[model samples]
Target: MKGGPVLILGATSGMAREIARSFAACGHPIQLAARNVARLEDDRADLETRHGVAVTLHEFDALDLASHKGFVEGLPALPDIAVCAVGAMGTQEENAANPEKGAMVMRANFEGPASILGHLANAMEARGSGTLVGISSVAGDRGRASNYVYGSAKAGFTAFLSGLRNRLAKTGVHVLTVKPGFVATAMTEGMDLPEKLTADPKEVGHAIRIAVQSQKNVIYIRPVWRLIMAIIKAIPEPIFKKTEI
Candidate 1:
């Protein structure tokens, strides 16, 4: 699982791109997959030239379930590791006002990512090797009214990853769940996130690389999030519902 190519789904994402760079720096062949072929190619060239490792690009659309199987089948070889960073966090107000928007958020964060991982998990289990890493969120631990639409989707995704990990435990394939709090990236570019709590994409990238190498099952990128979420989760529902997060 360590030597083969690492396939990064949603490769063009700020976080995923950083993770790809980290792995590429470690001499792992990179298979960059995302909806933007142009961006993937750009990244391919950069990683190859910078890290001196083989980098391949693949066109991937997370919501396209029908295409997922064919996408994996088309890889040059089965990847030793797969990182899923596919997610969409629409505005809470927008998602609350529009059912379609909420549905899209749910699909992007849960259904679509889960569908692709299901395929990858089966393939890896059959081979009795490989690793699956999922980028979830701390919001999933407790659904706040501010972003329930996004949080609920991540909650489902977290549960899915946990179940997948349990099923694959005896199979040799490792599954790692990464829950990051506020990350400084395009996804939260305009928000005034706290400097102490917000993590840089490269910091997240380095953490994920270490977690995978160490075969960790679950990790919170910022350890403070574990304590914060625990307090929120411990609140009584009646009182918690009355307070804003």
Candidate 2:
């Protein structure tokens, strides 16, 4: 099924752009939102031609909490499905130097994405139908010494999605929690990532689309991460706090 008109927040990012392409190919109208509309014109055009679908660019600022409601109200059409792929992974060293820098990590990963998705969820609930996908991370499963700043925010986001899902459960809206392990994108270009757990943008896109079709509640992009996170989360707190990831 073509499902419904699709809206992607953070559409300029690697995974979001891939998702836009994947759905556009299936003949769904697309609304892509990001900070720079000018930069994504090429992506819009490519998807429009390749899929013969209508592609519209929307200017969005995730951190602009007050603007989220207006942003959703202004959409040309109430989307059938909304996918949020907006998040940031700041350098742990830089985040440690300043609290202001650290705050951005929390806002970007949790506050901003949650604000938008929360707004979308309300709209869908009113309509009595829709699907919502929140792209979170496995790091949220537990805090590690290496990237707790980023991971902590994701943890909050994960919880928010869970609560949103529960609230909308009877409203006929489907909510999906996506936990991608390690992704090789501009955000992680220089990092050393293991081959076993990392996924490229295409793989993330594919997993999301399939999950949507299946109406899955929670999914780990690399299935093994489900096992890995289980172990990490199961570890005793005393030992976990002592070990460095």
Best by lDDT: 1
Candidate 1 has its poorest 10 consecutive residues by lDDT at: 1-10
- Candidate 2 C-alpha lDDT tens digits along 1-245: 36568999998889998898888877789999999889999998989778888888999999999999999999999998899999888898888788799899999999999999989999999999999999999988998888888999999999999999999999999999999899989988989999988999999988898898899999999999999999999999999998887
Question: Residue 1's C-alpha lDDT in candidate 1?
Answer: 28
Q: Which residue segments of model 2 deviate by more than 4 Å? A: none
Give stretches of model 1 more than 4 Å off: none
Q: What's the lDDT of the predicted structure labeled candidate 2?
A: 0.92
Quote the lDDT for 89 in model 1. 94
